[model samples]
Target: MYIINFIVSIIAIIIGINIRRNKRNYLIIGYNKLDEKERQLYNEGKPLTTASNIFIISGILLIIGGILAMRSPVPNYLTIVSWGVFILFIFGGTLYINAEYR
Candidate 1:
């Protein structure tokens, strides 16, 4: 699980860089669906890159937590809180991007 989480973290970081740079390949969060006008709006705003950063950070945290969980009996409270934050960030980022494009 830790290995998988680490791999995901790496992938997320790469995708985040792509998003920040506005590359079309391996685009995250349905960004490729944007039309010309929407693309302009996205470029004018920071939400797209913000969302990517959020995902990258979340993935990194998850990787760290997963590794810690391996050697010890991970505490329930910490796991729960981490998951909640992750979900909220992802949801908020998605909402921001969708609302912007819409």
Candidate 2:
């Protein structure tokens, strides 16, 4: 169970690093869908940096939560809460990027 969390965290961290390093707007989801003209309207650096930070931070939190779950007697609750917070972050981040960047 905790292994799954670790795997997901690692993946998220990889994605965050990729986005931060690549600095390619095409790597972003909704931003990618924007046509060239629309895409040009926004500054690239801020949104990519913000998104990358969000992913990296969330990934770290997932890893910490997983470790806590492993040592906790109530692993189930911890896992559930961890996943719930992750989901919230995902949605919130998406909304934030779309609203702020676009």
Per-model TM values vs. the true structure: 0.62, 0.91
Candidate 1 Cα misplacement greater than 4 A, ranges: 25-42, 75-85, 100-102
lDDT of 1 by residue, 1-102 (tens): 556556766777777766667744234456567677765655544665666677688787777666665666765555555556667777887777667655
- The Cα local distance difference test for each model comes to 0.65, 0.87
**Candidate number achieving the greatest TM-score relative to the actual structure:** 2
Off by over 4 Å in 2: none
- Candidate 2 lDDT, tens digit per residue, 25-66? 776667767888997898899889988988888898899889
